[model samples]
Structure formats: C-alpha cells, structure tokens
Target chain A: MSETDARPGYFGRFGGQFVPEALSGAITQLEEAWRDAEADPTFGLELDRLRSQYGGRPTPLYLAERLSEEAGLEVHLKREDLAHTGSHKLNNVVGQALLTTRMGKPRVIAETGAGQHGVATATAAALFGLECVVYMGAEDCRRQRLNVVRMQLLGAEVVPVESGTRTLKDAINEAMRDWVTNVDSTHYLIGSAMGPHPFPLIVRELQKVISVESKAQFAAQAGGLPDAVIACVGGGSNAIGSFAEFIDEPDVQLVGVEAAGEGIGTGRTAATITEGREAVLHGARSIALVDEDGQVKHAHSISAGLDYPGVGPEHAMLADSGRGRYVAATDREAIQGFRRLSELEGIIPALEPSHAIGWLLAHGRDELDAGATVILTVSGRGDKDVDEVVKVMTELGIAGDLGNEVVDADPREDPESDA
Target chain B: MSAVTDAFTRARDEGRAALVIYLPAGFPDMETSRACLEAAADSGADVLEVGFPFSDPMMDGPIIQAASQQALDHGYGVADDLDMCRSLTGEVDVPALVMTYVTIPDTRGFARFADEAAGAGLAGAILPDLPAGESDPWVREARRTGLDTVFLASSVSTDDRIDRIAEVSTGFVYAVGLMGVTGVKDVASDDSRTLVERIRSRTSTPVAVGLGVKTRQQAAEVASFADGVIVGSAVVQAASDGEPAGAAHRVADLVRELRAGVGSR
Candidate 1:
C-alpha cells in the first residue's frame, strides 16, 4: 500500500501487507486513498498547514549547554518536549487520527501503559471528533493519576482493566479483547508496533514520520547520519521510529536503552532484549522475560514508561537477527543523569529517555566520536517525571526536598484538576 | 463407512459404550498433543474430537480456554492446525473427528476444509456454531468428500432442530449432557436421562450423550436411554492429572471405571 515499498516487504520481516480478512473491504479503500494522497503535492502542504495553523510545527532544537559543560560533550536536544501535550507521541497519534477519518473508522480504542498514549489517543479523538475509549491497567490508573485525569478531561472514557498482573500487559489484552468483540466499528490505535500480523508493520509506518523529520533536521545540522542513535524502549516505538531509517545504512549504529531497574542480573529489570529469553507473546515471535513455565514476568523500572517486561516484535527480531544492539541502564544511573542534566543543562529530560542519556553518559564522553553527532530521541518532556525525579533523588541522598523548587518536593497537582 | 454410520454400528454391535474424548491440538506442544490423541484412541475411545481453539470460544469454560491459550502460545497456526488430525493415523484405533467452533471451518474455507479434513484422515467435524439452515452446504460438501458432519444437539435446541440435526448428522447422535461447558458431571443424573429421551424420539441412529459424564454410574444411567455414552472433560482431566506416563494410566483407569459402570447400569 506504500509507494516506497516497490520491493516486496519492508526490510524483510519488518513490513507486510497482512490484514484480517474482515478488514479486507475497509483496508482496500484505505490503501487506495493513502497511496493517492501520498502522491499528491498538496498532501504535505495541507499537513504542514494543519500542523502550523491547527497544530504546531518545528518544536525546538536546544543545545544543553549546562549539561554539556559538566559532561564535557555538547548535547543538542530536539524539543518535541515543547510540542502540544508534551511528547513525541503526538507526532504519530495525530497522523494516525487523520488516517482514521480518511479510512472512515468513526471510533478508536487505545491501550495505555503509563497513560501517555492514553492522553495522546484522547487528544486525537477530541481533535477528530471521534468517540474514544482508553483502556488502562488498574495499577497504571493509580500510578499515573495525572494522565488519567488528562485523558478524562479530554473527553475519553477511561476503562480500568483488572486482569492479569493489573498493568499495561493486561490493559493491552483487555483492549485487544474489546477490539475483537467490537471489530465492526473500532480502529485499534495501537500505541506501539506489536501484536499480530500487520499491526507491528502498520504502527511502525505511522511512527516513522517522526524520524523522517529528525533525519532531515540532523542532516541539515551535521551533514550526515549521527554516529549512534539512542532511545528508550518500553514498547520500543520511539527507538524503532528513529533507528528504522538507518537500519540498512551500515555505518550508523542504533542503540536501544532499556531500564535495568536495580540491574538485569538481579532479575528485576525491564531489559526485554537483555534479560528476556526468546518466546512468543502478545501475538508474534518475540523475547519476553518469562519464567520457565511460560508465565510473563512482571517488569520493574523507575519510570512508569519503561516498566514493560517485553517489547514490540520488530525490536525482538532486530535484536535476534543482530541488526541492532540493546543495552541496559540502572535506575540509579538514570537518576544521576536526571539530576546531572537538570543541574547542568537547565532542561529536564523525560525519565524514560533519561535512561538512554544515562547510558551514553556513563560510557563516557570519550566513547563518542569527535564531530560525530548522536541523536537521542527526546521522546517526552520531563514535566510528568519531575515529581518522581525529586522523590528518587531525595531517596538517593543527593538532594533534600528543597522547598518548592525541588523536583520531588513539589506537591503533585490535585488529581481532579483539568490542566 | 460414514463416520456417523460407523459410530451407530459400533454402538449397536459392540454393545460397548462409546467414549468421546476431546483435546485441544497443540496443547503443551505438538508432540504432546499427538501423544494425547494417540493415547485417547488407544484407551478404547470410540470417537476423538480434537478441539480447534478460537480466541473467542463462546460455549467453552475456563479449562478448555486455558488449554487453548497454552497451545496458541507455542506457535500453532491455522493452516498447520487443521492438518493435525493426521496425528491419529497409526495409533487411531478409533474414528477421529475435529470439534471446532464453526468459525474455523468457515474462515479456513468450507469446501477446502471439508476436502482437506477428509484427506488428512479426519472422519468428521462437530461444529457447534453451524445451525442446520447454514449447515446444509457444509454437510453436503462433507458428504461428497466422504467426511462426516456431526452436529451438536444442545439441551436448549427446539424439538424441530433435533429432527433436522439428526437428519444431516451422519455420526451417532451427540446429545449434550450438561447445560454449560465441557467438564465432569454426574453421569446418570436426571438431566442426562431427560436429554437422552429427547434425542431418542428424533432419530433411529444410536444416540450418545457427551459433556460431563464423569463417573461410570452416570455413564450407566446415560447409557439407559442413549445407546452410547460420550465422555470428554473427564478424559482431559485424567490426561492432564500428572506426568505423561501417568496420563495414559489415569485415562485407562477412568475408562475402566466408565465401562464397568455402564455395563452394570
């Protein structure tokens, strides 16, 4: 259905034209319209217009001068953090919500991990005037009280999933069950590239647009691909989004940073690629941190966004096929990076992406090639994580809860507030 | 012989009750699944219905769904699944059938499934979803392919449906023993006797009651009205009770208990 895919499949096992037989009628229509719309010169023009007039564009690219002086390497930040709702997640959600209207699916259901995707989905649903239901784990609903309120304020009906481990996995399971039960009117806007058949392929395509923009931005800034690209992998969407373009380029290295909570060897880690053995989960062949008996293991992480035990199938295949390398960073190192970046750069990174920054920093600035640029996917802003960071830092004995300015010391906004 | 005709003849001639054992293919693993199928046949089961698991099995309870999920997690696909009926080939001393939701046969292609299932050493298919009105085409196709099309005669089925179901159903009539999912239940309970009587008036074909005929006493009571008794969930229970070696012995013991109970009854 894509114009660029004149050659069979996308990156071998990456993309497929697979769709459920029931979706044949609707997918055909969508494929035709998407193909034609993609070819039209005004497609980008209209998208740009909407992006600027309706939404915002060209967020910001700031150099972390304060942090660079401390680390001895200049770190340039792409301010997707400044964009509407505070994360790069909006880039794909807005695009897909547009496609849903084009495809005539009047409603959408999304499964959320830490409620970022839930908020993003609710935002899309509001913009497109479509009905939306966001399924959140009972645990996540309690942990991410703010995003739950954000989703509810955006007019989305938040459903609590009380099955399985009472987390994202269960919420995803329940959402998929809901979609299967209501496949007639539902377009499951998967937050990541995973699940059965075409889902992994489809979501990656939607999320690829972010990297496409970043690629152009980086090329304009530095004249070639970055030496190493890094991003956090919860469900592996943001990292996969950025690294996919350079997958076959040979020289460009892709590094996915997983949260090694405590550590990977300790058995409490969200490092799916590192700690997880091979197993089929969700719906595809992937690596999951499962016990010998085949039950999925609960993952641990400092950041709620990185708290999943397994990730999307493509990341698993990529790691298995040796196309990409995965590394784990301890939460302690991530906390240090959080304090380091905030203290040195005056810009606080999201706790999720901070793991990648932590890993890259821990390996030393000497590890980076001279004049070699490394693009760290600043997936989300640190606003949600500010309070969590303060709590962690205070616990780690680095800083006391200093009045109102302290990150963890700041009282979280009332759960009922609509901001 | 038509699987239906063969079932009736087996019940009429052997004077031995028919044991209908159900298993979800790919449970544990493909090897274990095949072993269980062979074990079911070797245990003197008259008919073995390999349950093809669906994501949504409306009629099934937790036990079967859990078994299905376990199987699906092991990389079982829809194409390779239908062909699993061939596992009964060498060890199948009894007629082998596929008991699936109507979705499988329909989604896989009706004619193709009928032909393939027959070619793959499959004797029959018992589809709970395909009602008589929609079953005509599949029944005809199955018959043409020399495959048996067995229909589940539910407790809730109207008297009119029992007549139509028996007309197209070539295998020995299957009278559901319980109102709910497949599991162990009192074999000779009043519900069993009443359901047996309901099927008795509809067809001359030997009637067998399946679903929850756990103990031999119930089997004996069920054997009173129905010519044969079909036991599924208890067999699965026996098969899964312990180690693989123990599974065969457990099943054999249960089968013995059932035969003795039915003989005395």
Candidate 2:
C-alpha cells in the first residue's frame, strides 16, 4: 500500500473517517497511539510474544490433499481455526487489547455478528484485566447463543442491540454510540479491517501476521510461493490479512469469496464487493449493499459473521485497482463446503471461510491452472456453527445426503412465518 | 449573509438565542412531517432543520433513530427531503436547512446534490458525520451552490480543530452539548457552556448547542450561553407521542415552550 493510502485513511477514494465529531478526539488519539506503537520495537516484541505464547501463532499451513484432489489443484489451508478463541479474530483483539492498555484506556467496547469477534475480544479483555462490553444484534444473540454465552463467560457484558435490522450493522451502530459516549475512558476495539482510517490500518497490520507467516511457511513447505491466496471477505479482515503480505507480489492472485446468501439476484446477500455500490457505511467509504437512493440495505447470510452490508474500504480499493478478484458463494454452496471440509480434511471450518472453500470447489479449475497451488485461510473453526448447520440441513431436506444436488432454498425465508 | 446566518443574526439582534427545531422529513409520513415543520415554523422557530432519514443514523439516539427508521419505511428519499425543504421554506418565513448523514449527498454526487438542494430553496445543510478534515470537497460543492455548510464541534474538540471547523463553517458552528448522540438528557451539560466559550474565543461565528436539549428548562439553560439552542429528539418525541391527529399541535406546543424558554434568557 502507498503511504498516501495509509495516511488519513483514504485508499484510492474509498476510506476516510466519516464519524461524528464526538468521537474525533478519540480517533485522533488512537491514530497517534497506533503510529507510536508501530514505530516502537518493544510494541512489536510484546505483540509477537502475545501471538506465539497466547494466540498460538505460526498456525500451520497444511496441504489438504483430499480437498486438493476435489478442487483439481493443490490446496493448502492456513489454519487460523487453530488460533485461540477458535478464529482468526483473536489476532485482532489481542493487538487492540494491548493498544487499549498502551493508550491507558481501562474499558473496551466492540460489535459482533457471529460473536467470534466478541468472544475473541472478551477473551483478550479477560487476559488483560480490562473491562469489556460487546454489542450484538438481538437477532444474532438468538442465532449465536453459544458464542453469546462464551462472551458472558469470558466476563464481557453483551448488549443485544434491538434497533435497525437487529444484526451486525445495528450492533456496529450501537457500539459506535457507546464509544462516542464513553470515549474518554473506553476504546472501541473494532473487529474488522473496516470502519474509519486507523481501524482498517490497525486491524490489517495486526492480522497481517497470517500472510507474514504463511508466505514463509508456504515457501519452505512447497518449495515456492502459491499461485493464489484465497479467503472469505466479511468486512475483509481475514481476507486482507491472508492477502496483505502477498499484495505486493504480482503473480499471486488474491481471491476474496463473499457470501451470496441465497443468491445475489434474490436481493438477499452479503456479497458487498460483488453486488454492492460505492457508499459510506459505519464510518468509512466502502462498497455497501444500498438501495438506488443510497440507503444501506439489510445483508443476509447463513453465517452471521458474513452478514454485513459493507466490505472493508481497502477491498474496494483493491478491487478497483484489479489487485484483487472477488467472487460469491451461496448458502447451499457454503454448507456443502462446510460439510466437505469436515469430511475430507477432518476440519470443521467456520461458515465465513467455507465460502472460500465453496467458491474454490465450484470455480477453482476455471480460475487456476490444473496443478497450480492455492493457499486458503480457514478463518475459524466451526464448532459454533454445528447446531445451525444441522438445522439448515434438515430444513433443506439434505440432512443425510452429502451427494445431493444444490438446493434452491432461500435460507432467509421463514417457512414457519408463512405457515 | 446566507439565510441561516441571517436567521442567527436576526435572533441575536432580537436579544435572544435562535430556536432551531429539527424534524425528520417524511417521519410517520410525509404529510404529517410537513405539518409538524409548519407548526414548528409558525410557533416561533427561527430556523427549521428538515432531517433526511437514513438507514443507519449512528450519531442519533433512540428517538431520532426510530423516527428515521419510520421515515425510511415510508419510502422517504433525498428528493422527498428536498421537496419538504422547498415547501417549508416557501410556506413559512423561517430558514430551512437539510440535516442528514454525508453518504446520502455523497452518493447522489456532492455537486449535484448541492445544486438540487439549493434549487429546492434549502438554506444549507448540517452533516453531523462530516468533520472539517474531510469536508473540503463538500465545502467546495456547497460553496459553489451558494449553500451554507454547518459543521459540528464537540466538547472534546481541541482549539486547533475548533478553528478549522469555524473557518469552514458558513452557517453557525454546531456545538454538540454533550459527548453523546442526539437525545434528551435530564441535566444540561456545563461542558457545552465551556465549549461555546472556547469556540467564541477562537472565532466570531455564531455557535448553536445541540444533541441533548429536550425540555424548556434545558433549552433556556443552553440559550443562556449559546447563540442557538437546537431541539431534535424531543420534538420528534412530541410528534410521535399520542395520536397522529394531534401531532402537529403537540409539536407546535413544544416548540412554543422551547421558544419561550430561549427568549427568557
């Protein structure tokens, strides 16, 4: 990335801080602190120590032979699912939690959808002994009860946001309100590589460790760099992290798979980069699913993590510059990938990254050469999604049939409501 | 002077703080929202802020959020907001401005939005989320269209930041009464008084305090130290309180009470 893109948080006309003045002081303070931390060697040392000692970093880059054969290419998995709190989300929270301490802020507030970020933030807060409060959509709390309980058990207060769509966007709105109110004493540890200037920059820097390690690991294990890097893009944290170190490498195609809920044509999807227009949402100019009049629309996905209206602004920049290629996978396809990874690789991948696997299974051969190697980041483990997946599978009448054809079920429709 | 600045000057000349009432256009529905704006204008409101409801209003409290949602649910759009501004400006003597998030105008193309708004008789616009640092393009567009740009300054704004905001703001500088979203607070913040003083020390632009003034007493308290007192959520609450039949009257009554309070200073 260019220095101009990083400073003042503009990525080729995509990212800028468009927040209320009430939070400008806090944002400025955060930017300054982040700059200072970036320059300090001790900050890097501490973050490294925390990553390896606590977050279980250097997560293995394993060659998934069975999945490779299925995709008709050599497929490798970046095992972020093996990280603490069961997702790559831990990578960001730990860094922000440390920054919160460094800035002398005693409280941290966050927004969560699938609750992975909340769970991760709560875990980090517990480790750091800082007070934590997480805002989640009321609907999401019902959908992701296990993660809600995990956050509560980790000593973070989970506030169920009841406004707007009662989803991730609403959760972000509520979190921002809290941050604006308590900015003097609290730090808003934004979960993704989205939001305003410093947040995308900060989260990317912290989560970039994924590719920083994966690149070297891939070189050592495979004797060369992979032809492509793939990860699911939900607010684009893990995808950005998986692609960051390789962004400068012209040969490695960076692929971002977005959740296409039922399908993009159905007006029920979270495929922001694929189907959205350029608009500002939740503090940054990014690709957002909005109506013709520019009002942000509700985004849908079986995976709560991927159900957001907007993608990271840098992703918009990357897509604009043709440095990144974004694709979409529907709910049925994601479920298939979810089951496929479980059976083939003995890993239950999170639904967020399952989109990447699904896209690869459906379109890998078309995008890659016959024997080309591809590294895909398994952003999280899917123990949190087992119940939801089972219910969805049963509802689709494909519970026991792994070889069943793709069903045309709209997962967002409530059959019971119709009844 | 711009109509918004003229409104502030007229209020200053009358020896009282300006009463700026904010009502979301197309709230509940378009007709009732227009009625409420008319009522506010008829009831001694010096300036009218017609809010364009956005899907996500992060800086707003529950009352405004609900109102905005209702407006959006009614299929209200930027064009509707501009029409409301035109009608209100024509129907009443009070200067009317459009208040909304930046994305609404940014999505419509800033220059195009500015031209349409100015053509529709809007005196200016207040985008709470568009700070001075990232406002050059918008300021340029508004300047070209002859529309005043109102930028917000909070209690936490440093002197340097306040200076920049004042420099760019053609309309009165909006001093957020507290470090919170737009809602009613039981107690008026003393921080607003200090913030206004700091702003006054830096620039001669009129300062309006908003974000928490709900009642007459709070309005009076704010008016005692500020050039303008803005009431948004309370006015919205009044319009949403009982029956739709009496919403306009209720809005007028609340605006009259706040106007009286502002004039008491």
Candidate 3:
C-alpha cells in the first residue's frame, strides 16, 4: 500500500468513506489506532504470538502431485482450510479483535454470510473475552445450521436479520446500524475487505499474512515463485490476501474466481467485476449489481459466502490496472471442483474456493505453460458446506459429469472494461 | 434559500428553535404525501424533510426503515419522488429538503441531480450516507446550483470534526442528538447539547439536532439548546399507522405539537 492509499483512502476511485455520518468518527479513530498499531513493533509481536499460540499460524503449502499429474502441470494448495476456524477468515478477525481491545471497546459486532467469518469472529471474541454479536441473514442461518451452532457454542449472540433479501447484504446493513448506535462501546469487526475507508486497507494488511507466508513457503518448496496465484473472491478478502505479496511481480498472474450463480451476463450471478457497473454499495465505491435506476440487486450463488453483489475496491483497482484477471465459475462447476479435490486429493474444499479450483481445473492445464507452477489458496474447509453441497448435487441430479461446459475457452480478457 | 434561511431567522427572532419534520415521499400514494407535506407546513413546521425512499436504508432505525420500505413498495422511483419534491416545494411556503442515501444522487449524475433538484425548487439535501470527506463531488455540484448541502455532526465527533462540518454545512448543521439512527426517544441526551454548543462556538451556521427527537418534551429539551429540532420517525409512524383520511392530519397534529414544543422553549 502507498502512503496516499494508507491516508486519504482511494484505491483508484474505488475506496472511500461512504458510510453514514455517525460512523465517520469511529472510522477515523479506527484508522488512527490501526496506523499506530502498524507503527508499534510490540503490536506485531503480540499478534504473532497469538497467531502462533491460539490461532495456528503458518499453514502448509502442499504439492498436489496426483492432481498436477492429471493436469500435466505443477499445482500447489495453500491450506487455509486448516486454520482454526476451518477458514481463512480467522486472520482478519484476530487482528481486529486485538485492535478492539487496544481501542478499549468491550463489544464487537460483525456480519456473516456462510457463517465462516461469524464463527471466526465469535471464536476471537471468546478468546479475547470481548462481548460478541453477529448479524446473519435468516436464510443463511437456515443454510449453515452447524456453523450457527458453532457460533453459539463460542458464546456469541447471533442475530438473524429478516430484512431486505434476508442475505449477506441485509446482514451488513443491520450490522452498520448497530455500530452507528453503539459505537461508544463496540467495534464493528467487518468480515471482508469491502467496506469504507480504513477497512479495505485494514483487512488487506491483516490478511496479507496469507500471501506473505505462502510466498516464503512456495519459495522453499518449489525453489521459485509460482507463475500464477488464484483464490476465490467474495468480497475478495482471501483473494486479495493471496495476491498481495506477488502483486508487483509482473510475471505472476493473479486470478480471482467469482461465483456465477447461473451464468455470467444472465442477471443471476454474483460476478460483480464481470457483469456489474461502478456504484456505491455498503460503504465503498465499487462495481455492484444494480438495476437501471441505481438500486442494488440481490446476488445469487449456491454458496452463501459468494452471494454478495459487490467486490472489494482493491480488486476493482487490480482488474482495472490489468494486474489481476477475474473469472466466474457456475454452481455446477464449483460442485465439480469440490468433488474433484475431495476425490482426487482427499480434501473436501469449501464451496467458496471451489470456484477457484473449478477455474483451474477447467482452464489451468491448457492456459499455463507446460512447466509453469500454479498455487491455489484453499480458503476454507468444506465441513460447513457438506449438507448444502449435497442438497445442491442431489437437486441437480449430478452423480457424474452432466456434460456441463465449465469453461467457455473464451476468456473475458478484461473484466474492468467488459462491465 | 429564502424558505430555509428565513425559517431559521424567524425562529431565532421568535425566541425558539425551528421545527423540522420528515416524511417519506409517496408513502401510501403521491397525492397523500404531498398533502401531508402541505399540512405539515400549514401546521407550523418551520422546515420539511422529504425522504426519497430507498430499497436499503442502512442508517435508519426500524420505524423509519419500515416506513421507507412501505414507500418503496408503493413504487416510488427516484425521479418521480423529485417530482413530488417539486410539487410540494412549489405549493408549500417552507423549504423542503430531500433526505436520502447517497446512491440516489450517484445513480443520476451528481451535476444532473443537482440541476434537477434546483429545478424542482428544493432548498437543499441531506444525504446521511455522504459524509464530509467524500462529499466533494456532490457538494460542489449542489453548491454550483445554490443548493444548501447540509452535513451532520455526530455525537462522537471531535471538536475539529464538528468545526469542519459546521464550516461546510450550508442550510444548517445537522447535529445527531444521540448515537443512534432516526427513531423516537422519550428523552433527549446531554451529548446533543454539548455537540450543539461545540458547533455553535465554531461557526455561525444554524445547528439543528436530529436522531431520536420524538416527543414534545424531547423536542423542547433539544430546542432549549439547539437552533432547530428535527422530528422524523414519529412523523413517519403517523403516516404509516394512521388511516388514509387521517394520515396527513395525524402528521400535521404531531408537527403542531412539536412546533409548540419549540415555541414553549
């Protein structure tokens, strides 16, 4: 991040403070506290200690030899699924929880989609002894019942929001309202790198540890950098984290796989970068699915986590600058990815990152050079998604390949301009 | 400009705070909403806040959010609501400001939105989502067309932040009375008093306190220390709950009481 990006908060016209008036002071204070923490070495040392002791740092970078041999390429997986919360969401929440304590706020509020971030936040608040409240869509609560139970076990109050589309977007709106009302005693632990100023930066910095660790691990194992790094982009937290360290490496291709619920350009997708326009959603100016009159539309995806209508502003900047390439994977394709990883590699991948795996399987072998090395960040484990995935598979009647075209072979090439 | 600035001046001269009332556009129907705005003005509301209903009102409390949802369900589009604004501002004598989210103006180009607002005879706008830092584009366009761009001062704002808001805010500095959304409260907090005082010390702009100012007592309490007392959710509740014939009248009655509350102070 540049100095200008750190202070005034603009990622090439994508990031800004577009929240309600009541949140401005809290955001400013958070930015200052975050900056101070960044400057303090003690903060980093303590966070590292917690990361290692409590949250389990330095997850493995395993070479998928069988899968690579099948694809005729070198393939590696960053096992974020092995994180404490069974997802990579633990990275940002732990950082924010520490910041909440530093700010002297006793309560933390967050919004969740698939309940992975909610579970991570609840676990952090339990560890920190901070009062935790999570807002989740009522529909999501029904979909991810086990994770809901996990959150309650962590001693966090889960609020099922019934307003709007009864989904992640509504949960986020409800959480913001809670923050505006109780900002004096509470800190909003935003689950993604999508919201207003300081948040996109704060989350990126905290989650950047993923890319930092993976870079070192890959270098140690492969003796060189991978030609491509890919991850699924919901609000683009894990994708940004995976791409952050290798962003400036021009030779390294950064691919972000979005959820095309039905199909791209079908008006039934969460592929914001691929089929959306520039508009303000939540607290940042980013590409969002909006109607002609500027009202935001509800996003659809088989995976609750990727059912968000918008992407992080930095991802917008990356796509705009041609530093990152974004693609979409349909629900069938993601399921195929999930089955492939579980069957071939004995890893039940989360539905969210299955989009990435889907993209790689459908295109990686043909697109990448013969000797090219590829790294895919497995953002979460699939335990939370088992029932939902099974239900989807059963409904679609997919005991085997249904002759679905997972890849079009014709790449969007430029997501920024296409939208 | 005359309606808003003159209302403040008149209120100051009369030894009371101005009573600002909020009602969403096209709640139930366009005609009823227009009649409600006119009735509010006739019942002694010093200024009127015309809410352009949005699909997601993230900053609003349940009451206001419900009202907005009802209005949106009534099929109130952005441009059509502005037409309502034009009709009400043209008919009513008091200044009417549009209170909405940022996505409204952002959907229509800022300059075009400003021009249409000015053409509609609106006094100004208050976008709760468009804070001071990121408001340059909208503010510049609004100012270009001589529209008062009101900015809000939260209860948690620093003195420097209050000063910054007071300096840029035109029609009035909207000082949030509490740390909550637009809703009803039986009592007023001391934080609003402190915020208004801080704002008063920094700039000459009129300061209006909103957020949770519901009842007559609460209105009077805020009016004792502030230049304007804004009532939103209560008025919206009146429109939402009352019968068709009594809805506008109910809003007018509450505005009258709030007006009396300001006058009593």
- The lDDT leader among the candidates is 2
lDDT of each candidate versus the true structure: 0.70, 0.91, 0.88
| Better structure of 2 and 3 per lDDT | 2
Please write out the lDDT profile of model 3 over residues A1-419, one tens digit for every residue.
63144337888878888887778779988999999999999899988998888878888999999878766778899999998999999999999999999999999999999999999999999999999999999999999999999999999999999998899999999999899888889999999999998899999999999999999999999988899998999999999999999998888999999999988877889999998888888999888887755777889999999999989999988887788999899998899899899989999999999998887788777777885798999999999888888778878887444333454645576677676
Measured with C-alpha atoms, the lDDT of residue A168 in candidate 3 is 95
DockQ of all predictions against the true structure, Cα-based: 0.05, 0.79, 0.74
- For model 3, the superposed segments whose C-alpha errors exceed 4 Å read A2-7, A365-367, A399-419, B184-187
Candidate 3 local lDDT, B1-265, one digit each (tens):
5458788989999999999998888886888888888999999999999998877789888887787777777777888898888878878888999888888788767899899889999989999888887788999998899889999887777777777777679989998887776783443468888888888889888999998878899888888999999988888888778587788889888888989999998
TM-score, one value per model: 0.62, 0.96, 0.94
lDDT tens digits, residue span B87-126, model 2: 7777888888899999899888898999989998888999
lDDT of candidate 3 at residue A53, scale 0 to 100: 84
Give model 3's docking category. medium
lDDT of 1 by residue, A274-328 (tens): 9887644554446678754344677888888888877787787678677688888
Scored on chain A only, each candidate's TM-score is 0.85, 0.94, 0.94
**Total clashing pairs for each candidate:** 8, 0, 0
